[model samples]
Target: MIIELESVFNTEGLKLPFDYELDLSAIQVSGYSPIAQPVRVSGKVENKAGIVNLTGNAQVIYTAPCDRCATEVSKEYNFPLEHTLVVALESGENDAFLEVPNLRLDLDELVEEDVNLALPSKYLCNEECKGLCMSCGKNLNEDQCNCKAPVDPRFAALLDLLDE
Candidate 1:
């Protein structure tokens, strides 16, 4: 999803409106593959005195397994994706600007990064998800387990004394 920025770069104070679909199939999460969806890329790119600027958002709906309950869950994300594009050698390798080759912007890659950065470290089906039971592998939210609960190792000594 590379777009040519040469024309946009030629004129000072020039602005170009762009909209495209971003594919997120390549990004990987811990236990689940994010369902590939077309993320919206909408914004205006401008050339201000030889500097390439972009102002817009990368929006998408991502589906993945819940980290706690293992249930399939979907999350909505709309992250701000703005960057100052700079020529690699000319910018002196600063983190404040994004460097590009051949005056092109990888729109898909940029949006993908934004989506990844916005994703939560942990995903839960809900705030109250009870998760799966260790004893019988039953979903605790659906059914309660009657199996003896495993005592914490720290409390094992107290349980041994009580048995005696």
Candidate 2:
């Protein structure tokens, strides 16, 4: 959604309250493989002192594999996004608008960024999750595997030293 900032930009005290819902299930984030479900974003954009201040709340459902157990899990996340966008007088004159085009705000990009920042670095179903057994590829949380644990040959000398 591209909001025209002409009105807000011209007036100092102008504010635009916007409510937008977007479907992000089809969009794929780079590092985060999980896709977000349709999200509701409601926010206010205020133009004060020649700066556009946007503050909003977004609610999204995220589906990702658990880090410990490797099970697919769906979680709901809400993130608050607040940022200042300065309108450039010219297209290439200002550094802020250099990366992004002037006067046009990419709502999709902003929403994607907010979702990415809200995600956790690591996700686990539970803190005490036993994860999976490497030897037999068994889910340790369900049951124990009968396979014996392998010991490194380099650690054999250390084991003998500990015995002495």
Q: What's model 1's overall lDDT?
A: 0.78
For residues 67-139, could you state the per-residue lDDT of candidate 1 as single tens digits?
7678887888778878888756463556557877678887777777777888778788898998876557778
On a 0 to 100 scale, what is the lDDT of residue 40 in model 2? 91
TM-score of 1: 0.75
Candidate with the greatest lDDT versus the true structure: 1
Question: Candidate 2 overall Cα lDDT vs. reference?
Answer: 0.74
C-alpha RMSD values across all candidates: 5.0, 6.5
Clashing pairs in 2: none
